[model samples]
Target: MLSGKTLVVAAGIFLLGLVSFGEAIMGGSEAAAHSRPYMASIQAVEGDAMKHECGGFAVADQWLMTAVHCLPAGPNGRKVVLGVHSLSQAEDTKQTFDILELHNHPQFNPDNYDNDIALIKLDRPFNSTEAVKAVAFLRAGGVNPDTNAEVETAGWGSLDNLGNRPDALHEASMGVVSSTRCGRSDYFGRKFTGNMICAHKLCPDPCDGPHRIVDSCDGDSGGPLLYNGVAVGITSNGGKKCGQVKKPGIYTIISHYTEWIDGVMGLQPDA
Candidate 1:
């Protein structure tokens, strides 16, 4: 029902800087230090410096999960920063690893963002500690949270549409929106797919302003969307603005790709 080519063209437009990448935690508060040990900061390694590009979460001793779009088109000069709360502060618990392999979903369509998920294998397993741990994820055939269910997401992305980002990690609490409603004509329309999930927190009053809405914005892509402490989704995309009314943040449903995840992790499915 979706055209990959069309989505590719749209992605191309984004690459040309015509449209902004929807990824960040708008109107959220800073997370407690090292509270989200599973959180992973994906950074692009530029000469003598590293720039935060997207968010991710550790899924295994050597594996992290994130949005496929976060991976560079050519040679990935990326690294994962784990067990960190503030990117600017150096903590003794901080751990860094070079990316050994990047496995993007074979069917991923960047244009439309369908199957917009990927797995990153670190060069070595993490040395476990209080500030560095792996997160549990939804398995294939797992039940998804019902509509309106409360969920949490964390990131080091921009705090607002003006592109203000914080050094410390920020988090937001929002509710899940049914795919049916998300696919409605007024929302994402036909662009929304079953493999995607939407989440948002409406402002108490529209007159209150966009800052009252909780959402993920630029630099937050590939972060986890948690439901009952389980990693259920990956931040995929959203509207042009961070917290637009009736337009929710979309995520790649992790449960939908458990098979692929298992394959990449070298795990066999239950018989």
Candidate 2:
């Protein structure tokens, strides 16, 4: 139920004169090195260089999750870089892997951005290390966080409206916004779906207040939204400009897709 207005994809390449709907981290601080072991950087091979495209996180030994929009053309030139805190440094803990397969949600709708989740299979299982590991995720029938619950997200996306990206990963704390509130006419309205979750720092009036807002912006697509040490959502989309009041970053609820994820990963369902 996206607005009739044309929408541009975020966290990746953008065409001129298009407003981006996806987002990255704004008003966040640099994350401690190797603190977020599950974080993954989805990079695209641009000629001889591998450029950062989106954020993702490991869910299992060889599987990571991201937004389907992050790999619109499939995984032809995509690679997953794990255990990387700084993109500029040659970290000894970095693990790079070729994408073995990509499993996008069968019912994904690009127009409305619904069911935006996708899983990437690595060519080989990850080697356990201090800076490389998988994180826990929400299971089917698990309790979802309540409104105002504190959650966190991290990425290497632009830090502000001018598109200032960072070499090191950054993280921010935000509060969950109820679907009812997020779906208000002034907010996302019909574009916000049940399968989606939203989070942001509270700002009564962005235009009038001096408060610094924290949110995901361009280049943060496909990242994890962690709550209570578990990944409950996947970064999907947001306002044209990040950190806007009443325009929280939208995410694909992981609990809603556990069955599909289990089937694709060949894991037994939780009893």
Candidate 3:
């Protein structure tokens, strides 16, 4: 049976005199420009070092969607880097934005990872281009997708549990598993809530050839779980060891919070 452990969310509280958890890039390969244009790299800049904390996505000219745990209330020296493919090199297509406001959900429960979503308002609007684009949300009241549907997860975290962070963005294919399966005795069990989703990594047949044991870990928090170009989930928590068999990565389901998100973004509830 699984122990009741509060699996650490990717980025620790940085702006509040807290420690920053160095985590990310587990089980994904380099991503291309067109693959995930809405992707945003959230960072904390301190003097000479700029650290990648979490991943987010633009939903509007001045609004972004991310995990509440990524940002603790109060001020922080954080920014969002968009339209870039590499973290080490600055490309002409890249643009940076200063975070003017962080609107974490009012009812967010950190103890159980409930309402693990938040929105970021940019100091200025992003000039949309081919490299930088806003993504559509998972429409409200949509039918629950099939458990077998492929979910594409992207981030700049680590490649393994205790590995080094990747210099480039990486993406991987995973499959949505039944919450019942994910909540089995061996998994999170009753700790899994309705707001959470579970995705299992796909391991290739080593006997045949190349196959990645794709699963989110370390620094993938706040990243998106995209389905048909819509972000349906956000990376939340997972097992202690990423990519472990039967230890699926959990995400915050977006559909359940569309009304809350709409309210925060000042859009119609049904919009």
TM-score of each candidate structure, all chains considered together: 0.87, 0.87, 0.85
Off by over 4 Å in 2: 1-26, 203-209
- Candidate 2 local lDDT, 1-271, one digit each (tens): 5443434343223532222322323357889999999999999888888889999999999999999999977997789999999987999999999999999998998876899999999999999898999999998888888899999999988887778899999988888998999999999889888999999885433322235577898898999999988999999998788877778899999999888998999999867
Write the candidate numbers in order of decreasing TM-score.
Answer: 2, 1, 3
Clashing pairs in 3: 23-219, 24-157, 24-158, 24-218, 24-219, 25-157, 25-158
- For each candidate, the alpha-carbon lDDT, in order, equals 0.86, 0.87, 0.78
**What stretches of model 3 exceed 4 Å from their correct place?**
1-27, 206-212
In what order do the candidates fall by lDDT, top score first? 2, 1, 3
| Best TM-score among the predictions, by candidate number | 2
Give the CA lDDT, 0 to 100, for residue 126 in model 1: 98
Candidate 3 lDDT (Cα, whole model)?
Answer: 0.78
User: Model 3, 51-139: lDDT tens per residue?
Assistant: 88899989899998999888866438888989967887868988899999898988888776788999999999999889899998786
Candidate with better TM-score, 2 vs 3: 2
Runs off by more than 4 Å, candidate 1: 1-26, 72-75, 205-211
lDDT of 1 by residue, 1-271 (tens): 5599989987898664422323323357889898899999998877798889999999999999999888847326788999988887878988999989889888888777899999999999999999999999999878888899999999998887778889999988889988889999999998899999999887543313433678888898999999999999999998788777677899999998877888889998979
Q: Against the true structure, candidate 1 has what lDDT?
A: 0.86
Residue 215, model 3: Cα distance from true site in angstroms = 0.4
Least accurate 10 contiguous residues by lDDT in model 2: 15-24
